[model samples]
Target: MLSYATIGVTDLNKSEAFYTELLAPIGAKTLMKMDRIIFIGKSMKEPMLAICIPFNKEEQHCGNGNMIAIAPGSIEKCDELYNKAIELGATCDGAPGQRIPDLFYGAYFRDFDGNKIAFNHFG
Candidate 1:
């Protein structure tokens, strides 16, 4: 039901570096780039995440209840990406662990621009 999701960023280049490195462990890479935006994903056919400067020429602010969750495939990945995100300057929203008794494992963080992201695994 989703073609892509976009998050506003103040600096495209900085956001690109943070996302590319943080997502590399899961095989996602830069798929395309336009004037003030960049799309990243495993491939063009898959859902992509776009980071860009807002077209309205206003400041970017993260929405209170907005977040993007990425399924990284395993618990180990959840931890790996969470740690990697921290190493790359993201602030921790939550640490990697079981959120549901035996169903969900996830980690959460806020990017440099304060967009919330989740590295998740659901069984």
Candidate 2:
């Protein structure tokens, strides 16, 4: 139902670096770039996640109930990505673990721009 999602960032370069590392484990790469935006995806033809400066020219801010979730293949991968995120300056919102035993295993963190993101695996 969703074609793509975009997150607002104040610093493109900094947000780019943060996302590059964060999305690597999930196999998403920088698929394209423009003056103030970067698109990420597993392939050029797939749905993308974009990071951009607000088009209205206002300061960027995270939304109260917005989040982006990624499935990185396994619970272990979820943990790995979560660790890598913290190493790259992300703040932990939740550590990697099973939130619903045998059903959901995930980790949550806030990106450099304070956008909430999650890495998870489900059985």
Candidate 3:
């Protein structure tokens, strides 16, 4: 139902570098780039994540209750991706673990620009 999700950022180049490397494990790369935005994903046909400067020309800030959830297909992969996010300088929102006993394994972190992301696996 979603084509892409955009996260506002202050530095386009820095955010682009951060996301491109962090998501590389999932086969996501920079599919497209514009002056103020870069789209990253496995393909344009799949859901993509966009990091960009605000169109309104104001300062970029994260919303109070917004997050992007990604399914890595397994608990172990989720853990690996979560650790990669940390290695890329993201701050932890939650550590990797089962969130709903046997049903959900997930981890959360905020990127350099404070955009929240979840590496999740559902059984």
Task: Judge candidate 1 at residue 78 and give its lDDT.
Answer: 89
How much is the lDDT of residue 69 in candidate 3? 95
Ranking by lDDT: 1, 3, 2
**What's the TM-score of every candidate structure?**
0.97, 0.93, 0.97
lDDT of 1: 0.93
- lDDT score at residue 26, model 2, on the 0-100 scale: 74
lDDT of 1 by residue, 72-97 (tens): 88899889899999999999998888
Decide which is better by TM-score, 2 or 3.
Answer: 3
Q: By TM-score, rank the candidates, best first.
A: 1, 3, 2
TM-score of 3: 0.97
What residue pairs clash in candidate 1, if any at all?
none
Q: How close is candidate 2 to the true structure, as a TM-score?
A: 0.93
Q: Model 2: how large is the Cα RMSD against the reference? A: 1.2
Computed on alpha carbons, the lDDT of every model, listed in order, comes to 0.93, 0.88, 0.92
The sequence of per-residue lDDT tens digits that candidate 2 reaches over residues 24-116 is: 877888889999899988886667789999999999989898999888888888898999999999999988899998999989999878999
